[model samples]
Target: MSFQWTFLATFLYCELIVVIILLLPFISPRIWQKFFNSRLAKAFAAGAKYYFNFIICVFGLLFLDSIRELRKYANIDSKDLSAPHAEAHARMKQFRSQRNFYIAGFALFLWFVIKRLINLLVACAREMSAAAEAHKQAEGATRHLEGVMAKDPTKIDPREIIASPNNPPRYVEAKEHEFEIKKYKQEISKAKEDIDTLRKEYEQSMKKYNELQDEHQKSQIQLAKLSDNESSKDK
Candidate 1:
């Protein structure tokens, strides 16, 4: 029981501070945003996370040691209770009560661990949500551009706006966009030409194969007749 008390006191007084540090990112995202972006802060967070894990491991070891101490103390206590001396028996009872109090301290450690896990999960969810939003925006922009490109290309000339001083910003931007659309259109045309060339080559190859197969079949039939005549002559 004394061992349990020692464990509780250690965790409450010392380990609790480290747990708060671990939870700071989740407790206040503003703090995370301010500090997490800096190189020093990132490095510190990495080091702190590592140190926190190390501290948890140490706590585990101490808990194990406490368990052993508790068992040993319990054995001594059982013997003391049986002793005729009331002084030692009262002392042992007090020690047992103290150790029992330490048993609840492990739950505190468990609470901290759970909080840390939730913080990590929250950070991951935030990043995934941001990424999803960015992808949605990009897809929307792409669809809008495709719609514009589907219209008549002759109407979207950048050169007409270039010589005019009163041209709007949109005209200049549209001109740049027109150049991109034209380049993409040319690429599409080239791709179509390549596809046609490949199709023609494939047809030509199939025709040649059929012609060769027909010639081979005719030669095989002629050979068979010559062999039959030679066999009859030999007989």
Candidate 2:
């Protein structure tokens, strides 16, 4: 085999190994996800699309060449077949071309399959992680609701807040309404307190203004009296 063909065969073997490893039952999606997310994998993934496309194109060209060669050899001249050595050589060429065709074709097919399997495993891992987080949140909420119910059983029932085995909608509209009403009441009370504080401040400001006015009036009267006495003394 030529160097290029040998390289292709090696690549095909590597792909086959990878597919086998991926299909192994003991290897979980989580492990695959971690490997794919690693720094080394990320660096490769950055150019993986272009790299895979280049490889596919090369394999496609090789496959086409193999097909052409196979067809060329299949139509060997009758003169060539008359010679036994020539016939055997032509047959050998045809077999090699056939082998190359299968190699390139399988390699190309396996490339797509490997890409798809990796994507599926990564997606599965992410979905599993999300599901676990959701379950944790649900459990925490259930525990909190249980605590709240323990304090005030009449206010909220556990069944009304938490979903049952059938996964019914948690009917908390009444509880939400009550909470809103209580919040509004607190806001109204706060507004009233602010209004009372403002009213007291306004009253104090008016009192101060009145005191200043009285002082100004008394000063004006004293100035007038002093002016009249000075005028009398001059007279």
Candidate 3:
């Protein structure tokens, strides 16, 4: 469970990194001025260059065109600040490819998760329903056998053999009884397995949700720090 949560957290981190990279052009310059004297701006400029280049390389042709456009916007914004626009511009010129890979990928992944949950719930419900139906069938069979026996004469009767254990109803080898028990056991086991699977998925999802919450808090803190630092500089 712990290992699974760790892997989920790592996946969440990659997702965040991708989102931040995609938003870099729109967010970075607004947070930092173009002036060379601004230390944070220089770091931001360097990171922007490295980050976009890295995206072009790693994501390759799949995200080429969208990335190029993004890089172009970032370059113009960088130029407004007298930052290294040429490097970003040059990369966009060199690599001409485009895809909204992240948006599509994220959406597909979400759809998959939703689809899986829907499938699991539907299957579980069916299993439980089958189990209930089996129980009803078995009860009905037993009740029928009891009624047949009660109608028989407890003393001497036409079909009742005095020495026979299953005298009248003779249910021990009845095909219906065997069938009922077999069907009930099978359905009940299936229902139990489905219930266990549902529980595991719920637990994993809960853990993932908690990890996401922690990551969100950390990002909020970082944003707060940026705001505080800006304010303190003015003061």
Candidate 4:
């Protein structure tokens, strides 16, 4: 094989190995997330698009060339086939062309597959991370609600204190004296509303977390199926 063709074959092998590694069940999404978020990975990702495009272009040209060679050999004149040496040479060229076609085609195809797999894994990782954060927030809200409930304002009434037998009744200034009592009631009502709102928020966060977990599971199942198929093909 020519150096270029050999290099393409080597690259195709590497791509296959990478796909298998990525699909391995042992590697968790969190590890993939950490790797993708690393500075080196980020730097590589910044230019990966352009590099992938260039590779696609190169492989595309090679694939086309292989097709052209295949067709050329297929259409060889009967006059050329009359000579055994010419016939053998044409057959050899056709075989090489076919081999190159498969190599280039698989390389290009695997590139796209690998890219998609990485995206799927990354999305799963991010969803799992978000779900965890939401769970934490929900727990915090629950704790806050517990603390607020523990300090129930209804246990201590300003009106009850003012109306106590030990205190002198101010009947003449009753209207003015009730002002503080009304303000406290309003404050207590507002606090209850705030607590309700917080409870609702916590519920919503938990719901979101559940949805993310479902999506993550689906992604994992899909990845497992894909890996299984690939492994079967290898076998």
Give the top-scoring candidate (TM-score). 2
Please provide, for model 2 over 166-199, each residue's C-alpha lDDT reduced to its tens digit, 9 standing for 90 to 100: 8676665667599898999999999999999999
| Tens-digit lDDT track of model 3 for 42-86 | 676577657645543543443343465556654434444455567
Task: Assess every candidate by TM-score.
Answer: 0.39, 0.61, 0.28, 0.58
Preferred candidate (TM-score higher): 1 or 3:
1
Candidate numbers, best lDDT first, in rank order:
2, 4, 1, 3
**Tens-digit per-residue lDDT, 158-206, candidate 1:** 4233354685534445565888989999999999999999999999999
Cα error, residue 55 of model 3, in Å, equals: 90
The C-alpha stretches of model 1 lying farther than 4 A from their native spots are 1-34, 38-40, 75-79, 82-108, 111-115, 118-122, 125-132, 135-235
Instruction: Give every collision pair in model 3.
Output: 34-81, 64-97, 64-98, 65-97, 65-98
Candidate 2 wrong stretches, greater than 4 Å: 144-235
Clashing pairs in 4: none
In terms of lDDT, the poorest run of 10 residues in model 2 is 152-161
Q: What is the C-alpha RMSD of each candidate to the true structure, in Å?
A: 14.3, 9.4, 36.6, 34.4
- lDDT on C-alpha atoms for all candidate structures: 0.66, 0.87, 0.56, 0.86
Candidate 3: which stretches are off by over 4 Å?
1-175
TM-score of 3: 0.28
Residue 186 C-alpha lDDT in model 4 = 97
